[model samples]
Target: MPEFNAPLRDMRFVLHQVFQGPALWARLPALAGTVDADTADAILEEAAKITGQLLAPLNRSGDEQGVTFAAGEVRTPDGFKQAWQTFREGGWVGLAGNPEHGGMGMPKMLAVQFEEMLYAANCSFSLYSALSAGCCLAIDAHASEALKAIYLPQLYSGQWGGTMCLTEPHAGTDLGIIRSKAEPYADGSYRVSGTKIFITGGEQDLTENIIHLVLAKLPDAPAGPKGISLFLVPKYLVNADGSLGERNAASCGSLEHKMGIKASATCVMNFDGATGYLVGEPNKGLAAMFTMMNYERLSIGIQGIGCAEASYQNAARYARDRLQSRAPTGAQAREKPADPIIVHPDVRRMLLTMRALTEGGRAFATYVGLQLDTAKYAEDPDERDAAQRLVALLTPVAKAFFTDTGLESCVLGQQVFGGHGYIREWGQEQLVRDVRIAQIYEGTNGIQALDLLGRKVVADGGQSLKLFAAQIRSFCASEPPYADAVLHALGQLESLSQWLGERASSDANAIGAASVEYLQLFGYVAYAYMWSRMAAVAKAQRKQEPDFHDAKLGTAAFYFERLLPRILSLEASIRAGSSSLFQLSAEQF
Candidate 1:
């Protein structure tokens, strides 16, 4: 079986040297004095231990055993319950939750590292905690004070798990036409009725109760998405005194047999007039739910990074140990009958691609986390607004690009293993199966691309894109290594954005036709920017940590030379426009 060890050194490098997370935290009034460099490092160390020791061992076994569902109750695999108890006691579920509600109050910058570790160790195990953390965020952000007082503490404490119920039987991406209904009652509560599918942690044995944040429409609400509202529905009703009351009308109808992450209970949840309270304003559920959805979008994106990291580790180890053939130039290892596969040029290409994409993605994720932290905690209004715009521009790119390349990286890792990669025992196949879902879920990558191109960029007249470009230009002004390459890529992105904006005026279908490719082009440019920043830091600090910084510089060079040029093909495809795509009619096939 493959093993996972958190890349603690690289993680620290990104957090401290590249992003300067501790310095930013000290400047934010809400985060200052909460956590410093030493404390954050200790937290990362402890997280690595828990994930590597407790969760990594269970990954394969959990997949083999999976989850058992009987009589409407779901039980997790062996050792999961015990592990959950230990994890809860450690207060890991609420690592980035609000401190006023019994959470540890860590910044997203530090929390993202822990999240990557959690998913890398075990994707299924991570979902239970991730959902709860996202739930706590939504409730704290939009829920009433009474609701927050009642729900936030338990959810953050891990005594109760959480889930977001959005996809219905008929509605997948078109949430505006959802059939779920919320009827207002006289006692200031509502009766929720709906059947939600693909609900993760909707029913699990790890927690005492499951808190579901369901989306439904009120009777007097407007049409389409504006009619939607958010509700807090728990499996078991809670009394005013904070004790568990009678069981609510919510129940798990069944579990879905999935391709991967089988240990997670993908539930078919049925709500039959379940007692639920309104969270935030009525007829504003989609907005309220976006609080959780955006968080989950980024969280799911990290899921991709985690899987890729684990796959790369196994493949790299295999390359070093598994001898295949002699090097073409000469025999590097004369003692052995054949040289290790790492000596092969093709194998080196695959490994370097994996390393470059994974490492570049790590830097990018930390950068996004910094933007998130700045948006929430920064004292200056202008600074916060700028960070918010960047977050809006980058979140979709993070989700789509990370997973899109994440799958590619995993496939490359598997290819390095040759025949053994196809076997189940090697664990490479499982990583491939598990990471594939990140591209589909939390709003499919296609939808994410459309949001990035149509809503974030073109809808704002390319202002958001320009704002982000200016940031990159400011960095390039310092003339760092690969600065010209990064600037050139940024220029391509700007020209493409203007082209799409002009096309949108004349052609209605132009945005959708070019969205996916546009997002890809945008992602490559953003990663190039990330690589440039890291290269600058690595050059300045190479003497301090020669081996680590040298590897970083090498990977950055590989990214610039070999990977960044893919944007050219993407640019050409985007310029082709919607004419080719619409040429074929429905009957032509």
Candidate 2:
């Protein structure tokens, strides 16, 4: 079995050094009194312990055993229930929740790293808490005081898990076509009826109850997407005094047999006139769901980073220990039959590729996390507005690019392990299988590209993109060592955005054809900026922390040299326009 060690050192480097997390926390009034560098480090260290010790042990076994669904109740693999209890008791489920609702209310910048650790330890298990946390966010943001008071505390306490029920048998990405209906009653509740498929943690033995944030249409509602509304449907109805009442009408029809994260119960939820309370306004369910979906999108993006970290750790260790044919120079381990595989240049290239991408991705995720924090907590309205726009623009990128690079890194990690990587015991194959879902779900990467380009970028008249470009230009002007290369890449992305904006006005298919490549190009440039920032920080700290700083600089160099060059190809593809994509008619294939 491969060993799992949390990358606490690199995490600290990104948080405290690269991002100057502690100083930023001190500056934010919301976090100044309650959090600091020490507290942040302590939180991360404890999280590492919980994830590495409590969660990691269950991963392989859980995957092997999977979850069992029978007679509408789902049974998670052994140790999952116990582990979940331990996890909740540690206050992890409420780590970033509202303090008034039995939560710690930590900053997102801090909370996200813990999330990364959770995903690294067990993506399947992470979904249970992640979905719950997202549900809490939506409730806190849009639900009435009565609803928040009744549900938030219990959900945060982890006695009840949560799920977002949006997709159905016929409607996956297109929420406009969903047929679920809600009928209001005299007691200020609605009877919700729908069959929501692909509901993660929809029905589980881990928590006493499961809360579902469902989307459906009210009677006489408007047509299409605007006709939808959001509802809170629970597995067991809550009594007046907060006690559990009779079972609700919701039931799990079945659990999905998936390629990965098998231990997570992805259920087909059937809500037959289930009691549901209105979350926000009527006929505006999609907006309410966006609150949760956006949160899940970022969380899912971190899932990619976490899985890549695991793959890299195992592969790095394997390369160091696995004996292979003698190196081109000579055998470094003469006592053994051959030197360790790390001696080979090709193997080194693969490992460095993994390291560079994983590390760069980590920094980029952190940057986005900070934006989330600023958007929520900044005192100045203008500052908050800018942060919010940036968040809206980049959330899709974080979700898509991180997962895309994550899968690529995992493949490279498996390459380093040779045949053992393909085998089950090594766990590298599992990483590949598990990380694959992040790309498809939380909105497919294609959908994410459309959102980023069509909605966030073009729809706003490129205002958000311009705001983002200004920040990049400001950073580049500050004269980091790789500033020129970073600026060049940014120019490429900016020009493409301008060109697409002009072309899209006339051609509807333009956004669709160029979205994926545009998103990838944007992702590469973002990572490059992150690398430049990291290298600058490392260069400044080289004397005091020689080894650590040198490694940072080296990895940044590798990224710029090998990975950042992909921007050129992406730019070429983006400039090719949408004509070629449309030229081949549906029947031509």
Candidate 3:
């Protein structure tokens, strides 16, 4: 694999030029004096160094060897233990976690960039830290003070890892159908007994202890998702003095041999009279679990984007150096055997597509991160509400579209390398395998789409879409440099969304049928608007910095000219309806 670059210039462009993340950081009273442009720059530099220098080299080896399980113990791949130690010691895991819980309390805008770096360098190693922070967030928000005092520091410090156990053999998207059971004990704890499959970081030797935030149905609980309760299940029982006690009854029943991310431990955990603590209110577990799931969904999308980034770099580098056929116009490199493969127009098309998406996806990720930060930390209720709604609406798109584009981009990257990309030698192939999980896990991209078209768009009567459209319209009306392209793109989005939101009510399955394509349409148009917005800023301020502005303009042009046409296809699909779903007889093929 090529040495990973920080993409520092692009990161800076998104932060200072696009979001003015520093100013937003300054606005928060708690972060007023703690953050500045210089400090932020240093953090990025340090994070990038950690990712490239420490983690990048281990990616391939991790994927090949994965986690080895024997008897009751698990072992992480070679160099992973050291890399994990470096990651934890650097406090990267809790960048956005509570400062009170031994975290840096950085905003999502900053933390999300670091996440991209981790994911870009090596997703397998990144999963350990990501899941830990997610567990920390859940514990901080809902767990008792005693539980927080005991677990937060360990998780934040990376001395222990965490997992969220919600899926079982029969339950994933439909959690109401889960069969896990949690029976209360006299000492106020619960004895949880059940099986949880596809639990990431479930049992690993990377950390000393593993904490699982488990979902189970209490004996006295009501029916459906409403009756599901959340429990805190630890691999080792904690002594009264906060020391690790003997190992608990829970253990990994088996490890799944998945299509990708082979190194990251995905386990089927079996609980047999396991001692657990209640974290949140009974029957309110789904809401509590979503706090972690929402964060994971975005990160999973970035996981896809990161793999795309790694693959693109490898492929682009290979294209520039590899000699294949002669240049089309003439025998370029006449003194040598052949010209570089990049001379081909179709190759250029693939590379440019990869570049446009990987970069555009980064910007989109930052935009969503900004919304999440504002939603939680914004003081005013209205701002918070608006931001929250936007996050809800865009999240499914971010998860589905970003990953879809990411996978497509990686595939193109692989195609650029031809046979070399498919083979194991170039390391580009690893990127493809590692990223495949992002689409399947984290509630699946299909589930994400359903959430968007059904719950987010139509359920709220298109209020969120209107709120987002206002931003597009405001910038389009006043920002002339972006006026024409953005206005056109936004108009298409508004028209489609308006119709989908209306039609969804009349047909119950309309949203589901249209969701995946609708998300793609939204993503393309949204990226078109973003590219234009960045180009507008670039044009006004950076006349001398043509390198940056030109790139933005080129990407914007590519989006509008090439990618935006997909809306026509999606519009057609959205209109396809349940002719295929319910139209056929029960046994039809």
Give all TM-scores, in the order shown: 0.99, 0.99, 0.97
Error of 2 at 541 (Å): 0.4
If the candidates were sorted by their lDDT against the true structure, best first, what order would they fall in?
1, 2, 3
Candidate 1 accuracy as lDDT: 0.94
CA lDDT of each prediction against the hidden true structure: 0.94, 0.92, 0.85
Strongest candidate by TM-score: 1
340 Cα displacement, candidate 1 (Å):
0.3
After TM-score superposition, what is the CA distance of residue 192 in candidate 3 from its true location, in Å? 0.9
CA error at residue 345 for candidate 2, angstroms: 1.7
Off by over 4 Å in 1: none
Clashes of each: 0, 2, 0
Question: What shift in Å separates residue 216 of candidate 2 from its native position after superposition?
Answer: 0.5
lDDT of 3 by residue, 178-287 (tens): 99999998999999999999989999988889999999999988889999989999999999998999989899988988777888899999999899999889889989
